[model samples]
Target: MEPPRRKASFLASMKAVFWSFFGVRKRRDYEDDAVNLNPVQVIVAALLGVAILIGVLLFLVKMAVSQ
Candidate 1:
């Protein structure tokens, strides 16, 4: 039988997704994340992170243009 899955906090899920965005995760960390995180959390965090990144870039461009 499979072991019970540990539910990681939202913050931890976000951190894992953030590191994944940069493609800089250690093997051990990845394995740990696999045990702690679920696909849905990762997908949601990724979408949120992408939205934030796009918003930041747009803000920067607007500021540069306004100067």
Candidate 2:
């Protein structure tokens, strides 16, 4: 008999999302994440990351234009 598998932690999912945003994930890591990560967690993390990126870009642009 096999033991039950554990779900991925929020931190782990966030790390996976971060690596994915940079487009530099290894195939082995991808496979591991696929098995461990929750789809909902991935989606939420991705959306938050994108929003943060956009906010940072807007802040930089505003600062550059104001100067």
Candidate 3:
């Protein structure tokens, strides 16, 4: 009999999110993440990532317009 698998940690989920944002994940890594990552964590991470991206873009645009 096999032992039960451990749940992925929040930090692991964040690492997965970062790799996804860059759009360059390996197939093996993707497969591993798919099995380990929690849906709720992924959703939260994605929302946070999008918000950060928007904030950065806004900051850059504001700086460009000011100059």
Over 1-67, each residue of candidate 3 has an lDDT whose tens digit, in order, gives 8754649988888888888888989999999888888888988888888899999999999999999
For residues 2-61, could you state the per-residue lDDT of candidate 1 as single tens digits? 876779877888999889889999999999998888778888888999999999999999
- What's the number of clashes in each of the models? 0, 0, 0
Report clash pairs, candidate 1. Answer: none
Residues 1-67 of candidate 2: C-alpha lDDT, one tens digit per residue: 8754649988888899899888999999999998888888888888988999999999999999999
Q: Which candidate achieves the best lDDT against the true structure?
A: 1
Per-model TM against the reference: 0.86, 0.86, 0.84
**Residue ranges of candidate 2 with Cα displaced over 4 Å:** 1-6
- Candidate-wise lDDT, in order: 0.90, 0.89, 0.88
In candidate 2, what residue range of length 10 has the lowest lDDT sum?
A: 1-10
Error of 2 at 23 (Å): 0.5
Task: Return whichever of 2 and 3 wins on TM-score.
Answer: 2
| Ranked candidates, highest lDDT first | 1, 2, 3
Ranking of candidates on TM-score, top first: 1, 2, 3
Rate residue 28 of model 1 by lDDT: 99
